[model samples]
Target: MSETHALDQIAAWRAAGRKTALATVVQTWGSSPRPAGSHMAINDRNEFVGSVSGGCIEGAVVEAAREVMTSGVPKTLDFGVTNEMAWEVGLACGGKVRVFVEAVE
Candidate 1:
């Protein structure tokens, strides 16, 4: 979904008193799938919208977002072709991505 739509969904979740997190690609090196502004909105239920690293590391971002939702602490995640999980997620593009995930207040 578009960032605007995803952000709207996050707002709706917050309105319903559901915990949520926002993950954004803060930095990237090489041929990262998504650009730095790419975003994802994740709820406490582990459901999410948007993409931070295409399909490559969105799952990881969701898991981290879930953790952030629970702990109320932000996290920075780094994934690259050198990481085995990158290969698992088909991020064979040999790029590196840095994502920041924080709880939605």
Candidate 2:
């Protein structure tokens, strides 16, 4: 989804008082799907907005975001989309991405 829509989701979640987290693509290597500064907003319920590594790693980001939401701690996750982990996540495309997730106050 578009970054605007993701921001809108963040606004909506905040308006509704739902616990939320924001995930951002902080670093990238090789041919990652998204570049730095890309955003994906996550809620307490695991619902999300926008793309991090396109659709390839959003689920993982959502999972990490859930942890951040629960613990009120920020997390930096690194995904080497060229390793076995990538195959597990179905990201055959090669690249590495670092996602930083922080709880939204």
Candidate 3:
């Protein structure tokens, strides 16, 4: 989904008093599925929108987003061929990505 649409959805959740977070692709290298500036909106309900890795690593991102929402602390997640979870998350296409996850106030 478009970034605007994702933000809109997250905004609606926030309006309903639900905790929310946004996960953004801040950096990418080599065969990345999604480029920097891509986003995903996640709420305390585990609902989400958009794509950071075109289906790769989204589960991890959502889980991290949940923690960010709870702790009110941002998290930087790195996944690549060298990371063991990269393979598990289907990021094995030989690319590296840095995602910044932050609570949405």
User: Pick by TM-score: which candidate is best?
Assistant: 3
Per-residue CA lDDT of candidate 3, range 1-105, in tens?
A: 457888998889989999999999999999999999998999998999998996879999999998999999999999988887855775868889999999988
- Residue 18's lDDT within candidate 1 is 93
Tens-digit per-residue lDDT, 38-95, candidate 2: 9998998888878888598888888888888889989998888555566656454677
Better of 2 and 3 by TM-score: 3
What's the TM-score of each model vs. the native? 0.89, 0.87, 0.94
Q: Write down the RMSD of candidate 3 (Cα, Å).
A: 1.2
C-alpha lDDT score of every prediction, in listed order: 0.85, 0.84, 0.90
User: In model 2, where do residues sit more than 4 Å from their true spots?
Assistant: 1-4, 82-84
Where does candidate 2 have its weakest 10-residue lDDT segment?
Answer: 83-92
**Residue 66 CA displacement from its true place in model 2, Å:** 0.8
Pairwise TM-score winner, candidates 1 and 2: 1
Off by over 4 Å in 3: none
For candidate 1, write residues 1-105 as lDDT tens digits. Answer: 467877998999999989999998899999988999888899988888888876878888888888888888899988987776755654668889889999988
Question: How do these models rank on lDDT, best leading?
Answer: 3, 1, 2
88: Cα error in model 3, Å: 2.2
Q: Candidate 1: misplaced stretches above 4 Å?
A: 87-90
